[model samples]
Target: MLHRKNTKLINKLSTALFLAAITLSAPSHSKPVKNTSSPKKVVPAADLSAEDKLFVELREAAKVNDVAKTRTLGSKLESHDLSDYVLYYQIKPQIYDKGAQARVDSSADAAVEAFLKVNAGSAIADRLRNDWLLVLGKRKDWANFDREYVQFVLNDDTQVKCYAIQSRQAKGEDSKQLGHELKNILLDAQYFGEACPEAAQGIYRAGGLSKQEVAAMGRIALENNYEGLAKKFGVDDPIADTVKKARTDPAQAFREFEKKEWRTGRENTAAAWGVIGQFLAKKLDRNAIKAYRLQHEAGHHQLLSPESQEWKVRTALREGDWRLVKESIEGMSPAIRKRDPAWTYWYGRAQKELGDEALAKETFQALIEQFNFYGQLAREDLGMKIHVPKRVIPDESLVKQMSENKGFARAVRFYDMGLRFEGNREWNWELRTLSDKQLIAAAEHAKRIGLYDRAVNTADRTKAEHDFGLRYPTPFKESLSPIANSIGLDSNWAYGLIRQESRFIMAAKSSVGASGLMQVMPSTAKYVAKKIGMTNFKVSELDDMKTNLTLGSNYLNMVLQDLDGSFALASAAYNAGPSRPKLWREKLPRTVEGAIFAETIPFNETRGYVKNVLANASYYTALSSSKSPSLKQKLGMVSPKASVLSELP
Candidate 1:
């Protein structure tokens, strides 16, 4: 039943090697060395203007994904007029990266790993959870865990690989020794013809083999099972007795496992069931799964009867079975009055449906006030209009829309048209969810087209929110605060643009080839690379500190000049491409808000990008303790009566 995903992995490996090769060959274009200058010292914390210090520290903490420092610093920076990049990445970076720092906490990591099945990739079936890797490691460094894992994989050359596996052997967790010896034992057992190469002698010389430990481990599914696993490793039955005993008590074992308080046996059984689900006799497996799925689907399983209906409520809520979820929860016993912090939202949902309007309002109000994404969802269900993911990655048609059609290209046009028309009679936001496009690509397409409002709203609504915002918030700030004053470009406003443009993601790429922290186009980055008299530059590494900031700030500085020192015009130029923003002036009937007013902008991405920056500037202002720059300020809409083009020198 083990439907191995190994083949797909091989294909991906091939692609990665190919791309990495190209990236290496193209070295001259992306050598990120900005100057001959020494790495600048971070400014004296003593000299930072108080608000700048708070945000800088928050930004510094976010560089390493330090969540605690972010929260603490955010509390202090509350008065700074800064951008939301501090919150999106600084406060919660993984929410965007899908938690890809490859770090984790123990309990939550276990839950997420259990859900993910594979250790890591794009998070799917991945629930939001606090990392648990550190806790599971008892606060040990990940390198320790990596070392243990490496030993299991590469036992030979052990001395070169690491310190002697003396510790694991002494602790009797000698997986490396077992894996190495077991492999030799296996090939010898399965010898068809050729002699086997000597096994990689491990750092841990296998001490007196513990037949008992190997026997005990053999049947437990530790995967490192020394004897029976040797079957896969090609080992002869050193002790068939262990397998015999386990087989004899299989039913009793299942029962006993079901009874374990820690639910260990239940987990073993679930894995067995999962294997069965993958590779069983078709008729038998289908029938069993059909029965199980039917029970779960019909709302009639022991997992959720009247007495234990709360589980059913949670189950339905988790799967978003709204129609039945509300009914099931409300029907639960009145005795089950309280809810866990985790379960409180379901209670609120039930209350809303029971028409207990006031109580429902209060419960949800408190829920959202305390939590963020889900609370936002509940508040919106109460007519507050918060963004939430439906948790469905596009099935197929959406993939087609992004990959096969003019879907991505058209999306930009449609998006621009929509944003320009937002708050106008023609702006229609909901046309997209039904448009058979992946929301991520669709949002980018919207940005390309100039539907600023639509792009912002839709991007934030989907699980792909960061896809649109990832460019600016992430790498720029990480490197920005560390070297901002020296690198220059008001860090406060830089943070604002980073937040406003791509929510501060260095790697965020629009549908167009606008790349890096500042959304510099790939061509533009190439030119910047040449201008600074440095050679190597990989497009992907644009998120790296020195190159991204150097190019980004220079671009910003140039835009500022052309825009007559107007941050709004510069930002618009940044979004629309500076030349286009400038040329559009003579081409379009100028509104007071510049040629590309929210309603008139032709390129969707620049249009929405401009507005988002303005909105984000307001939020950033709130965070950075700077005066919130008004919308008119961003759109060149100042003095609603006066035209910017008329004032242009």
Candidate 2:
């Protein structure tokens, strides 16, 4: 389904009006000023061709599942340029009902096959095939599923992957290899909608998985808050009851589990303790280490899922228990330890803390080349600083060629209609086979078209050629710099926050109602406006670039002051709220490195947000100034604060 956010239209219209009002209100001098700039020409909605309007309306009808309206609109667009999209929308409601295993009749199958055959090799064909594959898998139609699954390009759906495994099992394929594949896919329990849990049950019945392995899967599911999935693994009442208790009072759960003996076996017992540890760890409860210790003493640490193991390490980091951190990371599967740079960096830090200087140096040396948040930290750990890489300018001819690409044109049209999901899929689908130089050109094209998010994402895909300008484009520096500087905030830091907040999308509105370039929430915007003594500041004005930057910069400065000038804490406050970082800070036992505080933030979104914002700021600094400060320098120390002044919401 297309996710349409009407906030974009409201923002765009308000921005235009705000600019027009400013132009009209400006004082005129006696001397006539010559205007050399050509006015931007905007095509009115009425100017759109009849076919274009019908196609857009068809998309809107499909978005709300208006089957009758969609059919009516689809009929009008039968001869349109994008009739394939209309066809997809017409048949989509029949097969893709949310949460229902759609029963496909012979006619439905014939229609889908005809669509796929007609639109062969197109992105929408692959998309339709993907959707149809899920229904076939659910219906246990193995022959058709196998045929369509192979043709399904962008096989990125976890449920579809699980169903494919089940289809293999039904065909008497090797159970051992299929079981292994199923286990890897089942690791992501959060997206396991019916198909994965069923596949796991089938594997267990076939003796391809042990009881302990199934119990471990249940524990991982419970850890991800998918209690329904856990029950599907046959988790008993005792273990489920303990998990319920652990959600609110993990320490009590840990204590009770340590004393009571369950008949459900050691494996279930270990699972309970692992989950309790995860909950306790998120709350920064010291007993989290004790719960993990109980699991470790039972020799069931190996049974803990990778996510559970990572939480154990995070809890240890918060408590300053370096030995536990090192032990937990070493106990992780070699694949996981090598895959996540965060764990690798933490492992190196643990090694250094445990006095293994040579091993620590080796770990940091290898990690420094990764060029991410942790990579920057690893560089500083190795006594080096970030240096701006030589910028690779894209060929102008290649950039011009990108303008002629059909996929990009479709993506731009979807973007203009506020269908971001379809827009992003269309945009990224064409990027699969491009060379690094071509990728650079594509990113430059996205930038020129004001698709800043796509520009950043595309530029970030480059393996060798680097262009920091395209990756971190500063679109409104003239206005942003003065606003940030006037309030004594670093403009680079503001730019970094803006880049992470919205990717410079002018009409960006988050699900929680944050608006415009900086994604300022209405309440926060109003509060900042009132505090700054601005009159008649409407919530609608938050969409204007100047207003958003001003309010966001002021709120950021306020948080920075409240948090005692720590960028790490302020960034967290910006993503989450001021109260959360305050509570997080108040829980700190003593002064610690800012990186440690950021790594251990309970909310996953805010933790990554803080790291990315600070890392982005460091890169922006390197790009803008001669004296580049290290990421560590920007992350300054975070300490326990007794009181903070601001009452920011």
Candidate 3:
């Protein structure tokens, strides 16, 4: 999977040859260079405003864990109307350093309670409440845990959810409804850690989880390489042994699995088939054909977990076995069968292949309501044109209203001063009380102010009256399009990628120091500059739209050709690196649909990136073209690269 040579060679070739050919004659354009001048230093702490000096000292005291000093400083700041935060500084170290037990003993929970009483609706108070709940949960003080848990406003923490479920179960109140909800919450959890497994075990023992469910969960854990989790589930020895054996010799493992009672008992038989499906999916065994036949013939498909059944469909898809694909999709769980567009699209395809036009059209009709990647493909299936949603024009009155709002004004000021976190906080707080119409207005205001990312983010929160233009604006079209076109690349695709990369923030800089429009790495920019023969190129030039786009497009084109014309693979290579996608491709048993390939990628970040990029590209295509685009055509198919073992070290 190492792309060390490819990375180095790309840098060199991009800088040395590509730029050399065009740098001198490159068109000049006006793109803003961010002002990097250092800010003026504050006056000495001794001479600062009383509130400011106290704030500075309190922060330092908290950092060094000087509890006495923090308390003293906190007391002095009490009159400044910041007692809650000051109290937090004095108490935070006790919780962080010494453990929550001491904090509880020291009546730290009482201080948190007082803070919450005053700042009842604040995010900080909610956080402190969550922290205290964790301490109470640790102590197994279910009384206080139950009392405080109800007040924790968001109730979004997974660990807290597990603890809450466990507390409920301890009281012998594990209702069927509650158990089902808890099961859904923890179903695909990769690691149960401590709380979740404890909760799951209680649920399992209470008859909430059937034997089949336990085995399926165990298989999933083992497949995910979370052996500790598999052990936590306490699966039968045969299932556990099969999991281990399958890692080294799957065919032999299946043979061994068949000899056990797990293979025959009604409760265990379904899970046994699932385990075999999981194993054969990885192996891409031709025996999968027979496995599918058996799965259908025995009507065991209904028992397979969605994950197991998915692999069955994927395996069938890889071998281009249409009948199995149709059967497998039909046999999936109702939720998976009805809700997942991937399966739905393939199901429709399978129906068409089986000469059932009426069913195929019915399936395609349900998918076109949402304008996503699959929607585009579904539209093609129905012979309908793919057209972009109409742009929602900015309301000048709303823009003025947003501009006049004190909170948004503060956000603008903070953003102008390069305090993005504070700016974002203020912006979000302002948004908390706004109606959907007001939100659209705010998004428009954000767009006007060059905060395209924020605009898109804010717009994304609206559930009704979607504004596609606001969500998918192409701000740097004039500069970006030419570069993409010069490289014979689709401008829409490049824009979609840039939208995802930095959300059109011209001066955006990632934590890893990837700068500007494309988030190009400093090293990448330098190598590209050198390859293109830009003798005096400065790293700061990366912040300029014109330079960054040109270099980025060149590098993208290089990787595109290197990886082949498949945008799905090339996009993955772009985000990760060339060798990673190559390694991922080599793992596939045969050429499979790109959507299937994307779903199976190991890295969660890369998988999401590939899907979003493809989806985004499809949207952009519809936005720019009068004719409907085929997302499936863009995705194409992926095959294993030819074995080049001799070339590897």
Candidate maximizing TM-score:
2
Q: Please, what are the lDDT tens digits per residue for candidate 3 over residues 1-649? A: 1222223333333222222232122122234222122122222245456775676567555544455567667657654433444565665544433211213333455455555565566554666677677667656679988998998876766667877888888788855655566655554545244566666677788888765566565566676667887777665634566556665776876666667643465545555556666676666565655555555655656556566777777777766778889988878866656656778888998899889999999999988876666777788788887656555665688879997776677567546645465467668767877776778888998888888988988877765566777878899888888878877988877887888898988877776778888888888788777776788989989988899998888777777777678888888877887777787788676878787787666565887788778888777877777766677788898988853332111
Candidate with the larger TM-score of 1 and 3: 3
Give the runs in model 3 whose Cα sits over 4 Å from its true position: 1-107, 138-153, 170-174, 190-193, 211-223, 227-238, 244-309, 326-340, 401-434, 506-515, 537-545, 583-602, 625-627, 637-649
- Candidate with best lDDT: 2
**Model 1: lowest-lDDT 10 consecutive positions:** 192-201
- Runs in model 1 with CA error above 4 Å? 1-478, 482-484, 500-505, 510-512, 530-545, 587-591, 594-596, 626-628, 637-649
TM-score of 1: 0.28
Q: Supply the global lDDT for candidate 2.
A: 0.78
Ranking by lDDT: 2, 3, 1
A best-first ranking of the candidates according to their TM-score comes to: 2, 3, 1
lDDT of 2 by residue, 167-278 (tens): 9889888777877777677656666767877777788888887767776777667766778878887635347778778877888887787777455577667767778888
